[model samples]
Target: MTTAGEAVTASESVTEGESYDFVVVGAGACGLVAALAAREAGKSALVLEKLDEPGGNTTLSTGSVPGAGTRFQREAGIDDSPARMVEDLLRTSGPHEAEELVSWMAESSAEVIEWLVDEHAVGLYLITDYKHVGHSVPRLHAPADRNGANLTADLVRACDRAGVTIRTRTPVAGLLVEADRVAGVTVDPVDGVRHDIRAEAVLLASNGFAASRALLERWIPVMAHTPYHGGAGSTGESIVWAEQLGAALANETAYQAYAAVATEAGDILSWTTVELGAVIVGPDGHRLGDESVGYSAFAEVIASVASESFTIMDQRIYDYVSRNEPRFVKIIDLGCVPEAPDVTALAALIGCDGQTLAGTLAAAAASAAAGTADEFGRTDLAGNGLQAPYYVCRTHPALFHTQGGVAVDQHARVVSTSGTPITGLYAGGGVAAGISGRDGAAGYASGNGLSTAVGLGYAAGRHVGR
Candidate 1:
């Protein structure tokens, strides 16, 4: 039997006397999906979440979901297939990924998206061939808001409609095991009550250890100071319990670091730079990498840089976006400098060397005059140049999410170091050791985290005889 160090309360006792076919811990994307899948299979499922709201960090995310061979792609006439997707992921992430798990993700990604659209009524549209963190293909899908909040809102609505009981502010402290199988979970209700709820299977859909400093120090040594933007509830308590029950962990070192994050706030802001034709420069005011590359690639370079970099652009870039793409204009205007007429003062605020900034602008102008070189791959810069006034903003590498956790098999069963299954327990989402390795932004693929969460959660739900 699983138990928490805390005591049981009156409200927890109500759940303690109950039982379910499937008990899903965490109400984040993966947990919600797993609960829905179990309910679809006619199983009674209960979702235990430590937070009051349903969505976890996912709701706070830019809602880009990546999938290959999706119906949406077919409708859009985008050429894609599971095999090609797998090859691309392996190329980006390398051998650090579990072949079996990666294969499962690539093969079933389309179905997962389809489920969201058809079953959950989630509205999705094909945006630009948007590449995520490290994806080589244009496979990112987003709702109208381009934030995962839409997805989470729809999932929560669907779950509520389907009568999937969600226990908010209730944390799963441990798993209940019967013989070699997980039979239920022990919960610490928000009301300060503790109780045991039996289930045929338990899905640890909780998030990764990004929010838990203690867990990171123990499992991922390199991530001690990585700032987290996701929910604080993703503390890896489930992983800790699984390990206590003899489960093995894998790929505990992988994480996703965004290239340009706001210094005052941890919000991801570098995508605006790329979209607005800005080049990132190091402390010495030199261009760092090809700005034309995707955000993931640039972020990796920034993370490896000795000093945090800054994005340099011109008012013309801002004006072009404001006139053409109003949506992008907001990002640029809010983040860019020289909102006034003075460019040199903006440079001072952004901490760029005045002379060095002037030199860079002149060089860019010469390149533009020659019409031969493109700094970030766009020929538009050939004529435009930064001109007299320029804009710059300080940026730093931001650790937004962890990509690794307890390693699991294809069925989402936590795997032992000896390549054996730790029966009765399962993991998904960032908590499940990520398929991506330590290769940086080049290792990113669109929808890597969300797809893995849904795919593995689905697999785990089905395995529980739901």
Candidate 2:
């Protein structure tokens, strides 16, 4: 952790840079969307990506976004509104520092999705089958293949056609301040040269600090020892700079975690298995805490109690989940998991006693069938509990991303600790305080990350460009 006295300077001295209407840091989904939004408003924009690649965690995600009252939802005969979305978000998040931002995001959800689909020509389909985690209704939209890379590719193509200048391998080292207002950023464009790029407004879409062990230990100590499963570029520099500049931070302890990343191959075992009534068992073949808590919240439970475990699901559940996610099907094809014909065979494969496993599953099955409480108090089983022909995969808890950081206003302008917007400064994506409450993963609803990323970015760009 660098102290306030320490300088964020590099050995290379700062030089001059070409100016633009807006300068965006990090070329992930947020930055891309922001630049596009700026271009649409007749403004010149430039995006600086630290890594060689543009997509950060956005490329690694499933690219799901919650859009209430979207055209796709209307076409699919689903009734939803911004009021319903706000209710769902507030119910999941409880109360937080950013309740007003929640309302703004909910109101802008449909606009953001429609803007991307219509003007930017990004392909998005409404997910009508099932809602995951905290949503009261199905409102998430994703790419056809449910791959984030495809979404990133589309964003890149749109940015290219829109004439947005993206400079990869360029990292912002520090912000340039003049008269207590952020004017631009100091960047290192490789070859040992630094440039001071001035701009009318700056947007920090550089994501969060999940990859930083120091920040994780400082905030969420429970997850400090777990392996981080997010983009490598997220080292907390943006948050650090913003804090040093007097920006207030919130929800620092809240983060998104996965309960079931493959132990052997280190791949994500889709949470759909658990959501569809699969159970996680310890070495003794006993069920863990309520699996209905969803994957992000269950991750903390899995990490604290056991180092490793098996996700046991019946053939019916496996077939149903895999039928939708082709990427998950590839995990099965790679021999990362095993399928067995019966309970005894599955137990042998997972190194558990047959009778013990059978008893463990039977109790849950009885509860699920009765539509009552299970032994672990899980009520919402996606379907009836497992029967013969089961599937099991070895998995462990993993941290995906931090959900909190610098606070921002409705237009994604950075807000100082004094409850005033920091002049000419803006932030979005993981750099901003999230709607997942002040701490813990339990408050996280599905698509909360992208909602903040895309929603705030669009608003910020449109505000600055206009």
lDDT of each: 0.70, 0.86
- lDDT accuracy of residue 83 in candidate 2: 93
Query: What would the per-residue lDDT of candidate 1 be over residues 1-466, giving only the tens digit for each residue?
Result: 4332234333445455778988999988898888888888888989998888888877867666677888888888788887888888777778784666788888888888888788789766665543444555567777765667787888889888888998899887766666667777878777876778888778888887778888778765555665556677878777777776666666666666566665544455536445555667777766776655555555666665634777666676656545533444445556544453454664576567767866666666666677856564444343656654666556776556677767788788887667788766788997787777643445656567787777888788777653
Residue-pair clashes, model 1: 13
| C-alpha TM-scores of all predictions | 0.86, 0.96
Clashes of each: 13, 0
Q: What are the C-alpha RMSDs, in order, of all predicted structures?
A: 3.9, 2.4
In angstroms, how far off is 373's CA in candidate 2?
A: 1.8
TM-score of 1: 0.86
The superposed Cα distance between candidate 1 and the true structure at residue 132, in angstroms, equals: 3.8
Off by over 4 Å in 1: 2-15, 270-272, 290-300, 303-308, 313-345, 361-392, 438-442
